[model samples]
Target: MTARGLIFAAPASGTGKTLVTAGLARHLRRRGWRVATAKAGPDFIDPTFHALAAGKPCRNLDVWGMRRATLAGLIGELEAHADFVLCEGVMGLFDGTGPGAEAGSTAELALMTGWPVVLVVDARGQGASVAALLKGFAGHRPSVPLAAVIFNRVSGNRHAALLADATARHLPSLVCLGSLPADPGLALPSRHLGLVPASENRDAEAVIEHCAARIGTSVDVERLLRVALGSTLSAAGKAAPLAPLGERIAVARDEAFCFAYPTLLEGWRSQGAEVTFFSPLANEPPGADADAVYLPGGYPELWPDRLASAQVFMTGIRRAASEGAAIYGECGGYMVLGEALIVGEGQICPMAGLLPLVTSFAERRLCLGYRRATLRVDTNLGAAG
Candidate 1:
């Protein structure tokens, strides 16, 4: 298929790639272009912002959690839906799990999908040195081609001209799309997990509008659109979402349990499974007829007391577990399934007590990585390995 796509990558995180990508999505959508947006890592927050900006359901293109076929199928779904697809890269373009590990990096996705990457550089302090950085990024991996460069947090036109002229002199092959000015107000507010969830942000639409207005004035939308449309990936027909865990699946979705992957939910529907949702924070419970319940990861520690006293929700979960309904938890959800949770010093809250696990958030230790495991027994997910 001749569907075009572009990857917005940066030298590092916090370099304004998300803002630029969101802004560009809105700008293009306003011009009557059907834009498909995707995030290039295991992030759920950015995609929400992307969806708000593009007026479409944003999807994640994670390299670590998905197989090549799965990624290809998701891209194909986008190709079938929208004329142009724009993706925001994670962390640094090449920074990933290991020194050449291709599982969870933007560079790997670029190579896998053959999508051109536009380097989003933070140009707050340096001038000519910006060219040096772009040169390194362009040459660091010969397989990953750099289509263009857009400088973020630029001081003024003089600074942008310096970056442009230097890039023209040193790396004439690289295109300089332009630069965004330094605007502290443009930064999105954040909680523990990065930007606050878009659903909770009262000024979310205003934020998107601000970014779109500024980006429309700062960047060359026409040239950027042409470049994105030129880099097309061959289509792989959409694959069905993973099979449903049960005949009727009940999911907990709230500020405390909102990290579920949209692809997984869509997959369940594609397989003709019925899916339902409830909010634990709102004292809601799973449907009485649900055969399975899924609690995804989120900030359970933030409201231990509220969750502990959620009698209706807690009782429904226990009742479901007693009825032999399949129950699964991930990360914070896993913590909530335990006997008790240590929220702070001298404070503990009783939990569902479904599992022999106790979680302590007071200590504040971080565990972050990709996991590989084989089920030792038959479970609702699938047969044992």
Candidate 2:
């Protein structure tokens, strides 16, 4: 099934792309359209907000992290399930891994899927200059398909009109969907890892609803839909990215371990693996019948006390390890499997102790990038080099 979709992108970060994308998704969903949402890159945070707004799981389409067939297969899955798919861009529209590289950028996704981009421009500190910004992006990569523009954070009606007039004069061919006026109420709370996950936010539904109402009234929904290009992707043969850990895999889920990729799990299921989930936050452990356990990354550092007190969960994890179950953890999950976790001000908390490691969050440092590694021995991930 071919689905009409568009990528909600921006000239740069903080241009309100996430909020606008969520708002528009909710807006379309409220109007009785089946909306499927996705995030452009390897971001775990924004997709949660998108899922909340769309009332379905939001998948990530990473050009770098995923294979071409996997990306095509995901888009095909979304298309079959929805009337419209809204994808929120990462960082900036053209920003990717390295200097002047478009490998993993939203533009690459647009080119791959043949979905047009609705560029979200922050109109807070500009008048006619908004036109120049539009011109630059529209002409930046001609093949990327910049179809429309949304002026976000406009100060007033007069400011909106100025943006409209400027766009009309300079880039008359470019569709200006409309402007979202600056409203403090439309803002979502943020933490060190970007916007707080929707699961942790009690007001997530309320926030989505508020955004829907505001954006529905402000943005030109009909015009936006009219400009949305049908996805050029076709369903690819189902291929798991990696072999399943075991016949039955117990996955750790909840606030502390919520960074598992949907595609990875789905891929495992496609390969005839039985997957189940348990919440460590609720003192739950992996299923007894499972032969493998996966602990994904999340905000475990923030819930040190709760995790330390999860006696049952810790015991179950230890039992799994003793039973020779294939156990794997990454990032926060790795922290949880350690002997001790050092929270703020040197507060030491006991952990599962599956690994002889001690982790600390006393002074956080941002360590972001890509890495390539070769295994020296047999591990849960793969065999030795």
Candidate 3:
């Protein structure tokens, strides 16, 4: 089942979306149904929290960051595992990045997937005007279903009743899922972007448990799940992977280097690579029996101390490369292969003693995009040209 139905939203940031979606996922999971959680944009942090809440990895449906055909195939794969999916929209429901790229916008995804909207509005200041807001958002695009409205930060029963009455008049058929109180405590921690990465927060597990339990108790889980169960999910294309580079490739998958695209790994496997995984932060080295090694990108900045101290992992990678194993590194992985990395807090630490160059966070100035780069050396990834 492809994610049959999902949530389209507004550009309202800090609206407790994390709690609401986490709670929704948690609620669905408790009912013995598998839930696949998705974030609408290029957000890696939110998905980790969703996975923690639902005990399954959350998939991203960013049109800008993925190939349309690849997106369809992965969605199909997840549909088989998830009874229904809870997709949380990024900043407002319409804002997206890049020039001439409305593809990544939540509105576009809603239209493409034919999923309905569950607009989460901060209804504190709006009394009768809430009706007008709902009307505008509801009528923006016709085929995009306006499934329900959930008022967040309502002050009291009277406030909730007032908003509900106005909303009913504007859109009589629309359901108000429920009102969430302005609980200052419901707010989760955030960093430079949005929510802090799940790995950095020590109390993250406890927080997810609380969110799941609360969402399960308060939200109308059964009905929402029923609606999700009714949606259709299918793949957009067939997949036939190319031949693998070698017999075995041990990939680095700890907190520091965990950024492989799902399809790429699946592609490698399909081609005949006996892929294996080991953690770098845990000090596990490349598997002794492996023919090659891979290091992807992640928060190598956060764990400079850990990565610097990861002697065995560093040694294993270098040893494999020295032995002419087809080793490779992506962005963060590329940084890790260098001599040193300067952490965000202005601490310089040594990394894997491979390349003689030092990488500094000071050099980070938004190098992210769907890049097309030419290879300069032969590696497990591809050929040198």
State the weakest 10-residue window (summed lDDT) of model 1.
Answer: 229-238
TM-score of each: 0.96, 0.93, 0.81
Leading candidate by TM-score: 1
Displacement of residue 317 (Cα, Å) in model 1 is 0.5
**Candidate 2 displacement at residue 298 in angstroms:** 1.1
lDDT of each: 0.86, 0.88, 0.73
- Candidate 3, residue 198: the lDDT equals 71
Put down candidate 1 lDDT per residue, 1-385, tens digits, no spaces: 3568999999888888888898888988888888899998888888889999998789898878777677888888887788889999988998777666756899988887888899998888898887778888888888896789998899998998998999999999888888888987578788777888888888888878888888889888778767774333445544546768898999999889999988899888877789999999999989999999999999999989999999999999999999999999998899999999997784899999999988987887866667788999999877899
TM value for model 2: 0.93
Q: 80 in model 2: Cα distance from truth in Å?
A: 1.5
lDDT for predicted candidate 3 compared with the true structure: 0.73
What is the per-residue lDDT of model 3 for residues 1-385, given as tens digits with 9 covering 90 to 100? 3445567375477777766787777766777777877788666777777777778777777767666665666667667677777788887666656565555777777776666778888877878888888887777666666678778888888888898899888788777766777765566788655677677677777766666665555556555544553333345654434446568989888777766655467788877789999999999988887887788877788788888897888888888888878667777888888889986766889887677778887656765445557879865556897
* Best-first order by TM-score: 1, 2, 3
lDDT for model 2:
0.88
